[model samples]
Target: MFCERSSGDVQKEDKSSSVAVILCFFGEQQQGGVSDEAEPFMGSGRFGKSPTSPLHHVKVVSSPFHVALKVNFLCQLFIRLWPDGRNLQLHFRSRLSLPLFTGGKVEGEQGAAIHIVLLDVNTGHVVTSGPESTIKLDVVVLEGDFNNEDDEGWTEEEFESHVVKEREGKRPLLTGDLQVTLKEGVGTLGELTFTDNSSWIRSRKFRLGLKVASGFCEGIRVGEAKTEAFTIKDHRGELYKKHYPPALNDDVWRLEKIGKDGSFHKRLNKSGIFTVEDFVRLVVRDSQKLRTILSSGMSNKMWDALIEHAKTCAMSGKLYVYYADDTRNVGVVFNSIYELSGLITGEQYLLSDSLSDSQKVQKWLIYTKNWFDFDH
Candidate 1:
């Protein structure tokens, strides 16, 4: 027999002819009394004998040896007398961005996803519908690094004991989907992946912690959610990672002095300049003949760090416009790799004079400098 209701619900009553009550889990903490007048302890075979039914005085404080641990401790003490008794947390509704490589997968920093909520710290609600909204949490891998300006006045047991420190020796290994259930109180965290590489730590940074995972009876009293310190590296530094905007068929050694085969990637693949849209169509048609083909083994600061890392590639607005025939004199505006965008000039066009012996402006400036070895 058991029943607790401040609207936290937990009921189980059957009183078959008396003597069923049994509260000795340390005699309700040395008789702090929750109402009882003695007489209850009859057990003898099938722990039975129900004849006149009478049991109804159970205020047992702790040893719930079953019935799912007394319905998980009266649903975590009625979620600390819920509704307004404060206390409840697990925040990180997203925050863990940056180049986190190692074995890869953890995203955000423009990739989004990585949630985990639950909150309620005195009505800032989000405990969505009670019993801590079907808890499950977990996601570990934390070690030190936190200071939102010293987390202003802390205290949810100091941010749930500030991620109980973990990483020291062989730690990293946090494979994919490290548990996640909660639905209305949020959860997300899917493809986690870490597998080592905190770059020989000494605060090379790393953090993620969550909690509440153990036979799910998470009866509230939440509080535990880290994730802000990040750095994973070494998946061969994601092939020299640094592609904020870069991506037009990537791989021109992912920019920055193009090192895949080094020496400015063998002089941009022996000058045919493979991908990154063929080095942004030869740096928009002849950046001084692509800096005279890597200025003799490159240097003007490595050709301005490979033309500021191929000007952070992200072009492809798909425009074309070209005109020279009907005398619109010049109109040029290329893109989608024809590069040059916008140059119309006709009021007695001069464009620095010599229209190179115009055969229709030298066949539209040799079809925008052989728009990538032009075949069609």
Candidate 2:
């Protein structure tokens, strides 16, 4: 058997071989917001490698800290476990690319907004009910490298308990304080704006540090959470030129095409469907996945309507009254909208200045009357 010492050193646990042993899974308070590699966990005490030994849950110390594995798998009788920190996990994530549009955004020029949220950390399960939770948000913006060893940079936490420690000597990235109420009892809204006196920062890398207050879960006082640092840059027209906007609005949940039932959307998130583009891809690529998008169930009529809705959104912003033509589905698109506008309205009526307005109307009426009589 083997165990992890509090000093973070791992060695053989020869003394505790006869008895089951538990190791404290303590994660270091990371400063840079980068993805830190957690130490390896070896099973012991009726766990780890011996199915005949015994079976029980392995409780970890940190409660709610996140650990990302490069290539991991769980097998039949082998298991490692931890308390879910009373289900409090901040949703702050490591963002690689941030783009901007008119609706609002996280990265780009000034006047963009930063949205905050707290999720009952999903460990491959759908948490349908949200607690009467309230999260206090405070963001600190830094001009340079936030991960410097000497500085106590941003720490990502969802609970209120650890937020005080993170903000002890830190400065915020935004100009002023911020807060808001979440309808689902887990999210809020805030804009990213600096005070007028703050100098222009058109060409600098800024790290978004966040802290959230802890809330109650099943009568136990759960601790707060610090999220991973999200790096936002002021790209100054560089990001806009290369990037393309998504088919749907940035806030995919608020879309009308998807029903407003909150539980339905929650299931979508659990299935790795966040954006409409992600949802559309699933519906178009696989029929079974589309029918099963709702955990409860959806009728074929509703499913077909949504699939058509998604395809309409994908091809063009406007919805068209036509079925998908699989035979001629592939195509080369042109700027035919403007080119056909003259034909649609009649090119002669548009340019003939000698014809009076009434005469033009009469000509169109006479031609339409004759055309409709024969066509009908």
Candidate 3:
């Protein structure tokens, strides 16, 4: 029987038989309950031999019988133990490469996707070999902008509590595929969307956390893997959101402060301005008329947002030059509903002589069209 001491020493309870004990950085051996040469564990000396070995402390406890070996390496101790007279085995408790989440800011309610992979912090490389090659990951939503860098020293219960607070005292309802299986240490979280917008607060944002699935975390110690804080706009806006360089046929409600069947939409519709084309034409032809239509309820900021969105509409490539038969003084250039006369001037008068004759009008129109296309 042996007993571990508080000090850095080992002693046996039995005093009758003589015993010799020798402990090495590589392994330990026993002769008459002790040995002069240590038995090499795992066939290697990772902790090096004595004098240079980091193995500074060894303790043996009896009754159930176990040996606790502790070493100082990288500010952390590598602990190994032998229990219940079992075969000597080495357990490496060293830090491992962690999984990381990568992808730019997420677009909420858009079925956004993100990526995850095992990363070697020491080498700064994506690790695809070993147990990380193929592993299952479970993702959860976390509170963004929370204090405590990268959630260090946080427990599972603490994380869950924070998540509950983040989603307004309710656990976030994450929909779509959340369990991702990696191949070559890389996996994509596809078609994942949040059921609720981030909490309404100043600088409000949300984060996603990833962890190894229960059965798959056997050997991998995946440290905190989370995304940067990001905002998620209400999903309702998605239906009215307009793409850049919007098509001419896009609805008026796509503009800011304009909702379907709302006051702005009703007013615009009453004025026969239904599509973006109609709105653009009315703005070009009668600026005050368009302003007066929405001037009652819309604010300057709202008007700016509306105009900015409308400006992104692409004009028809086809151009037409129009003039009155009575006089060449009046001329207008139109590309779809957009009046381009403001962009080009004086040149129209030069082609007036050819345009004046009614019989030659069609012929000169083609010539004018070709000239404008070539020049501009």
TM-score each candidate.
0.37, 0.29, 0.53
lDDT of 1 by residue, 282-340 (tens): 77767898888777767798777767777777876776656655656756556677754
* TM-score of predicted structure 2: 0.29
TM-score of 1: 0.37
Worst 10 residues of 2 by lDDT: 334-343
Query: Ten consecutive residues with minimal summed lDDT in candidate 3?
Result: 74-83
**lDDT assessment of candidate 2:** 0.38
| Better TM-score candidate (2, 3) | 3
Highest-lDDT candidate? 1
* Model 1 clashing residue pairs (backbone): 16-53, 17-52, 17-53, 17-54, 18-53, 18-54, 333-342
lDDT of 2 at 97: 37
Candidate 3 lDDT, 246-285, residue by residue in tens: 6678887766578888999999999898888888777775
Q: Distance from true position, residue 249, model 2, in Å?
A: 25
What is the alpha-carbon lDDT for the whole of candidate 1? 0.63
Checking candidate 3 for backbone clashes, the offending pairs are 28-39, 30-34, 31-34, 31-35
Residue-level lDDT for 333 in candidate 1: 54
Displacement of the residue 151 alpha carbon in candidate 2, Å: 20
Q: For residues 42-160, what per-residue lDDT tens digits would candidate 2 score against the true structure? A: 34423344533221233332323222220121110012122333344444423323432222244422333434445554353223354434535445444333344443333332222
